[model samples]
Target: MKRWKIAGLFAMALMVSAAPFQAFATSPEFAYTAEKWASLRDNKLEYGEIADLIHEYNTTVRQNELDYQEYKGKTSTDIAEEYYDSANEVSERIRYPDDDSANYANQIASALNSEISVTNLTEQGDSNVDDGEIKRLGYEQQEKNLVQQAQKLMISYYSGKASLATLEDAVTQAETAYTQAQTRKAAGMALQSDLDTAAEAVTNAKASLQSAKSSLEQTKQQLIIMMGWNYNDSVEIGSLPDVDTSVVSKINVTSDIQTAIANNYSVKITERRLANSQSENNRATYTNTLANQKETVSTNVKNAYNSLVLAKDSYDQAKTSYDLAEKERAAAELRLSAGTITKKTYEKQESACLSAKTSMETAKLSFLTAQVTYDWAVAGLASVS
Candidate 1:
């Protein structure tokens, strides 16, 4: 519910952003049609698409398995059918000695059954398959994330009640600044540069608003793609419903990180890459294990390990930054109300808050991915232990 609420809020923001600034007494008219976004959200996608893809992949793998037992029934039937047909032909041909039909029949039988030895299609259940499955799941999870993000955008679009409040503030700021600039110009109290600067600020603010709208639009498209829609297909976003945020705030990042590490696809992919490299090293060592080659292998391992660690650190920093930003925003608001800061300064503070939030979101994602990779590596190491 919280998620939906956030989405609704974002949707409202997007809508406002999509419209003219109204702050300049004139909103820019763009040829933006919300038809696509609306269409997409209205249609609910079934989980069948993903399930079917997985099923097909599994069936193909099973078919390729060289267990021989899997094909026993079909193999036996085919062989028997050939033998019976040959026997009938031989019986008819045996009526004459010149025929050699019996010999031919025996040869046919031998050809069909004698050389029916099973050939292994591949090494059964290699780590590659396991890793691939994990990666597919990871891709699915990424899709889900995109979908949820889209939902957030939708919520943002509809949450006009809240968004209007902020947007109004923005408009007021722009208008007031514009008026101040014009009044100073008329009174010859300010240079043209000052007026221009003020005017530019208003324009920049409009651009920012539009960019935010564009983001929501892009996010909607992303959700469509995640749901397995073609890129060319447009979706309509539905009216967003409110969601509860309590659960979101209550989520334990550390625990979620651990879970992601254990099950996320990104980790599996990295693990697979590392495994392949390790396997190459093993082969190399056996063939011509040189000091330099050994060192190279060690270096590769360290590089992969370092990536995971760096990602983890980035996430941690982002989370901390976000928390600090929240505190700073609070302080900034208070200062503004106390007349210790200008409205422009307050806006700057708000921008900082948004930046901090963005950083935190990015970091959380990175941390989850890193945790997954680290887990995959550790899991592999465990088997060796």
Candidate 2:
């Protein structure tokens, strides 16, 4: 009802920042304007606009890979030719030496001349060494990393937008508090000091709101810069893309760990890198290094899952409190009907119930945010909801 005997929102509302988010269909999440969502769905984004940037990135990386191969091949050919030129060179001093020294110099030059063949010199200083191959492989891996990074940025941008909704709600509540205090003071029921405190709260709430807008703007601009778009400050994005919650029920920690280890962009790149090695030992080294990376990825998944568990627990506690607030509110309503309590006290109880509801919603958002993060870590965006 938003009715309250108090002139201001309880201390709890100002002390705690409510985060707007929804983890599942039943979870509480912030709602966005249709216009904003339309912008995101439309062509407002410049870089990696269509979900994953893998295909476009692959095209650029492939072209660079070809150019790298050409450059390495040319360098190797140049080095081989330099070897041939060295073997063919003769010393001008060979003619002026003592007979024995001159003979020895002539013999040494003759041997180098005899070995002046492409195949023989190339064998000693092969341009097709593992170094060039490894270099190209590294380039490929770097491109893949960029794509993965873009995906993470996409997730972060949407998550921040959700918080913006919470800030907007906070601003409204603060303004409401200030208005109520002014009304109370006019009737001599509230002190000037109380009015001033509410006014200060409104100011703080507005400042926080502005800060949130600026942050969202910064995130949107980052996407434009990364995707090679013209500098634009007025990018509008809609609601977060929905996660595939169906997979949440299918998460197999062991299987997911295996998938991340085997199919992670880096792991796949390193596996391909085995072909870049010239010997068995080098191939084994690459294999072992990538294999060892599995543990780290598994740990990340577990950590994210642990956070989700904690968030769920918090949500449960909030639900219990909300239920208790509902009971208290019902009791107050009955007392008011029986003429056993003042109307102002009943209204206060109603306000407390509303506050409890808001807290419960905030907890729901927290739970959803944690769920999304955990799903992304273990099963990726495809599996997240």
Candidate 3:
């Protein structure tokens, strides 16, 4: 989102600060939705304040990479060091007689299992090689997924705000129209039926406004839960920021699937299980399951990508329709003002424009959700072993 747009949003919140809002509490914390949304999106954004957590994560990842690199470098430059005591075990097994050889083999096996000897000293032998990487990736992906969740929630929050605002305006308009209709009817210029219809419009608009408010509150709770905050906090969300679609272009289906196969947590877990399993049947089962998992991961990525593409297409179509409706709405407003069209006709055109915009936003939300999910599945914790 542009800085100016964000500034404008805050400005709007400041404008509405004086309004009497009856929420669940009386505290004047973020009475406007824009203020709360901006806090969640920026100031109090999840993981932002927890620099220690991110620092720990980076430290761990860096150390693991260094360890892996050290292991690789040692293998390349110091073949003698690599083969030392671990390679001696193979010779020791053959050098011993039957009984001694068997006992020594058992001892060596126990040592290797316990990580107490030089038998399993390579990077492949170290459990931390996979474990460390997986943990770090999981943490990084979790933060990303949360942000994606926040983005969708933010969009919905703004949608709810718009609906509520629109309905509130409608209620006021309907009430004024109703009062005018009643006055005109008394003067014999308008019928009782006209007054009744205007009164009903007011009732309907008020009901819609209430419904919109309720929806907004529900979403607020969702955002609160996501940020690990108290639900009763003053959480008036700000305007929805635009999603960065540049990430989408970076996603490669083939490369991502390969990455998932090599790194996915489930795949890595299953691989570890297969490696550690003593039974031939159990190993075969885990291997088959892992194979199936690879296929599933591939399918999920493909499906999510497809969904995003379809959503973008849908948004394009919706936006085109909205643009045309906006033009119609403008003409309707002019016609109504000129007394060439009825107020109802003007309202219908206005509603068409609003509905079209809502549809476009809905499509945009779907695309972003799919984009986030796909990114997680292919590159993040979902993909790491």
Candidate 4:
């Protein structure tokens, strides 16, 4: 009997240990398990996965989604029915002559009042309003905003990396120039001022590189946290996909403006309010507000398109500059092979080419950001007035 009791106790403990996992598997509250979250933390995070991450892990997005899910298919009438049931329950309890009779009476009164209020509101409120859909859209917009933020941070982080590389090259070039200056000065071929300038360049280059590194790390931290990871969590960040320059040619500004106005969440909300307005004055006010909102959305889309155009132009110019730098670098390499230029001169040319490449990359990132903004505008996710 003692061994059987011990075995039963062990089985009970095992069941207790497994209960939480069983609950988690069946629970509607959690869309992901702890194991899933752990897997996400372990895997490399990519730019394309930001939207899904935000939906799954962002606190605000998760709360909104849960709220929407709870209220889905539940109308004001359903809420009023719930209130009526509470009132009826209180009334039933009041029939019993208990010591808390007076308190139960007050509770019944309050419940009845609440039920009446909800019923009246339901009768007067917009009959066509789908609260669930509105909440779902709100949740979607939150996720979109977070994803956009992550994209911007990712772009800045990669751009900073490119700039850091260019700075590192610049420092090497500066050190080489300083060494050559010292050699020339010793031979009475260069001035002390030249050596001083070279040393200053090296110092400035190192300082810039250090500052860039700090800024990049801060950006990475923000991006990681935004994607549902702890600020200091170590994870590999994948590269941004190549920008689709072809999208630029596909944009139709006029059509896009209409699509933006139609799909804008704020505009939809305002229209709903206008539809539910009881008084003529309230209706007119909301009407005017809705018109203003549509106009603002249109302007935002136009501005985003213009910005994209300017970014593309700048990118093109940078690409031209980079192409010229590449040719010059290639020519310098040939000259070095022929012993026509000193190693210091070749290294300086190499640094210049790197700088040009960094500039081109930075320009491309700017254009990509602009492209994303325009896309968001058309998708009704951009910032309106």
Which prediction has the highest lDDT against the true structure? 4
Where does model 1 exceed 4 Å of error? Answer: 1-180, 197-223, 230-302, 335-345, 369-385
Q: TM-score of model 3 relative to the true fold?
A: 0.55
Q: Per the 3 Å backbone cut-off, how many clashing residue pairs does candidate 1 have? A: 37
Task: Choose 2 or 3, whichever is better by lDDT.
Answer: 3
Point to the candidate with the largest TM-score.
Answer: 4
Q: How big is the positional error of residue 152 in model 3, measured in Å on the Cα after superposition?
A: 3.8
State the C-alpha lDDT per candidate: 0.46, 0.56, 0.58, 0.73
Q: Which residue pairs show collisions in model 4? A: none
How do the candidates rank by TM-score, highest first? 4, 3, 2, 1
lDDT of 4: 0.73
Cα lDDT tens digits for candidate 1, 126-167? 212233333344444443444334443444443323233344
lDDT by residue for model 2 (166-218), tens:
56667777887899999999999999999999999999989998987888677
The order by descending lDDT is 4, 3, 2, 1
Alpha-carbon runs more than 4 Å astray in model 2: 1-148, 180-192, 233-239, 244-246, 268-288, 301-385
> Which ten residues in a row are the worst by lDDT in model 1?
118-127
